[model samples]
Target: MSVTESKAKTSVKTSKKNVKPAEAAALKEALEAAQIELVPLSALIKSPLNVRTIPYPVESVRELAESIETIGLIQNLVVHTLPEGMSGVAAGGRRLAALQLLLTENRIDAGYQVIVKRVSDELAVVASMVENNQRVAMHPAEQIAGFRKLSEQGKSPAQIGDQLGYGSRHVQRMLKLAHLAPEILELLANNTLDVEQCQALSLESDQARQVQVYEQVKAAYSTVSAHLIKRVITETEISVTHPRFVFIGRETYEAAGGVVREDLFSQEENDGTADRVLVDRLVMEKLETAALAIELNEDWSWSIGRENPLQNYGEDRENYLLLPVPEPQYTPDEQQRLDELYATQAATETYEDEAAIQVLIDEIESQAAHRQWTDEQKASCGVVACLHNGELCILRGIQKKVKTPGEADAATQATSRDLHVIDRKEPDAAEGISLPLLKKCLPNAHWLFRLPWYNSHRKQWP
Candidate 1:
């Protein structure tokens, strides 16, 4: 017999020996009312009175089988006698199914014996209901402690999960909770901090820091949110979505000895945070290299790289002019394809399909033309490479030369005429001039000239 069965038999014998005369008679009567026997696995059938109507998951049954194989069944099935020597199980239906699974897998023989408590037919329903209703689930903290104990016993997460009918990742998550600071664990046990808050704390491996943050938040707010806890813990770190981190890329950043702390609860695969200084330096280096390449390939007079060009330049941004990008010219066949793509995009039923079609359209458009810079423009204009929305953006035709007052007035006149051409209905052409120019005849229209239709008509300008 297994250790479990031996202990069970020993306990029963001890209980019988300790019973008094009156109690012994009552025990005998109860034993006669419900007999315990070793019934054949094949002889047990699911009873009509079994409270659990929903079928057990296949994974649940498989895990149960693994548990039974490792440690013999600890509980006995409750069954009632039926005709022709068959017994209907009212309780422990999952256990019965698991045993059958083991038999089917050849882990156990077809004649394997299952321990069962045989009761009267009328008591079967009561037994099933009581068995299900009277049980209390283990608390999360207690579950975590149990998993930790199993881990301490040298069992791998996979093995522990198999015995407990949990996924290996779930077991690992619970084990992480086990490593939390004693104070944090106490908070979890006493319901002061929820599981999610503890999970947020787990992102920080330093128990001291976790406790510090917990105490700080507890004092600062009446109630703490999981997001707030995570933010406080990771305040100094750069999120994966940060422009610098995105520009450097996770692989390159890691290669440079940067560490990333991942959020296990996040649905996004790459959701994590990293050190800001390391990622910022990497971003600057990569941007500088990209700018150098662009300057050499395009024959620009000068090129400068900045993490954030607008922020770095500040008020000085007004000194330079942003040249508009030229429209792409496509052949008849390509244009037809583009039109068809747009039509299909408009009719697309799903966002995924529309995005895919847009990609194809972009590919065709990109092949049609490349940006061109006039020789005069190249001599006076430079390029600025900067990070925008986590992408490397190259701004060409950035005029660096300051304009003379006479030249500025002439340029303003030209802009006025162009604006007039656009809005022909306006009686006074001067009214078409942008507000910034009226305030001060600023030569650079980078800040004020932002009409959406201006790009398509840029080539028409003098």
Candidate 2:
């Protein structure tokens, strides 16, 4: 017989036959304690006031069922006696579903007994709420350890998945954590490393490398994402879609022995697939070299190529007292082009077709670029090229510092406009005006001031 059947046979009420008063009292007290009775599956019903009236997640219920089938019910269900000799389950609704599933699969019979505790209606309701509300979910680290133990104990991935209500892939993913270094695993246990980061680190074959990257990232950033960790470990450079890469051409970059990191899971669509990243910074610098060569060919006074334009520009300003500020001035032709661009933009408000809208956008951008910097402006002003909207943009006519030799008390002012001052004191009232005339003309004057001044000047008044 099953454990449930064995327990059920001894769970029924027993006769308190001929006994001493003390023995009777002891039996009575024993009844107050929760007793494990294996009640029949057919006798069990759901409580209307049960906290979990709705079905639990199917996967969770399935897992519970698998566990019960494998190891028997571990916890006793809190139940209350209902009318017509029936028992209603106030708690363990998921357990009931799991038993039902086992019965359906012929793993257990309808007469299978489930361990339960008989309680009062009020106690049953409270028990149900407490059971659900006070329950804590197991941490991922704990789950990993559990699954690893099961695996070591001869449980296959499929078997583990079946017993845990998880898919085979999920089981496999969990198992992968077993390969992590002990230190890294300890980090996960203490909440230092999150699940996603752990998963990303798992992609690397070397535990030492994983630990190294984890420590490096944890030191640098408050939180490290999977994508960032992947990029770091992969040593990939800027994306091919970057404007500088496009400007230099992928063929030229690859011919120079640059590595490309392609997304392993990306798919090709009608438009295109995900862009790959360039992995060698040295090869990337070839574009800078080429640019420098062209700039030198133009006979520039001085030219420098840098991977990061803003940092270079900032460094250039560090030694100087002040940065050059570019003042933008438009020639007559450029101003006309700007006006035409604005006119076309206004015309687009009436455009309805997609093609026409795209054409208008192209025209607007072209005009804007054309009028951006005139030849005269480029000749006299400096330029900066930096990343903008994942592309390269050239900013022209940045101002250089003005040389003021031997000037004292140099200060930077946001603006040179004169401050406007307002005088609050009004024109003094006529010195010899009559008191009655003054009161009549200044009807809004304070009564107290008028009365005191009038009384003091009574002898001088007309």
Q: Please write out the lDDT profile of model 1 over residues 1-462, one tens digit for every residue.
A: 000111122211100122234533643464467766898888988886564544567898899889999998888888888889888997788898899898888999867888888776544544554354334223456556556656766778776555444567667777887889989887766667777788789898899989998888888988776788998988889999776787788999999999999775566765889998888888888888887887888788888878664421334343555555445577899889977886776676775876577667656654453344567777776767777666776666676636687787575445433321121110112222234322344456565457644554444333
lDDT of 1 at 387: 74
Per-residue lDDT tens digits for candidate 2, residues 115-222, read 888877655544554355345333456556655756766778776555444556556667887677888777766666666667667756588989889878778888
lDDT of each model, Cα atoms only? 0.66, 0.54
Off by over 4 Å in 2: 1-204, 209-302, 307-344, 347-384, 388-390, 395-462
TM-score of each: 0.53, 0.29
lDDT, residue 176, model 1: 81
The deviation in Å at residue 156 for candidate 1 is 3.1
Candidate of highest TM-score? 1
* Residue-level lDDT for 128 in candidate 1: 56
Clash count list over all predictions: 0, 5
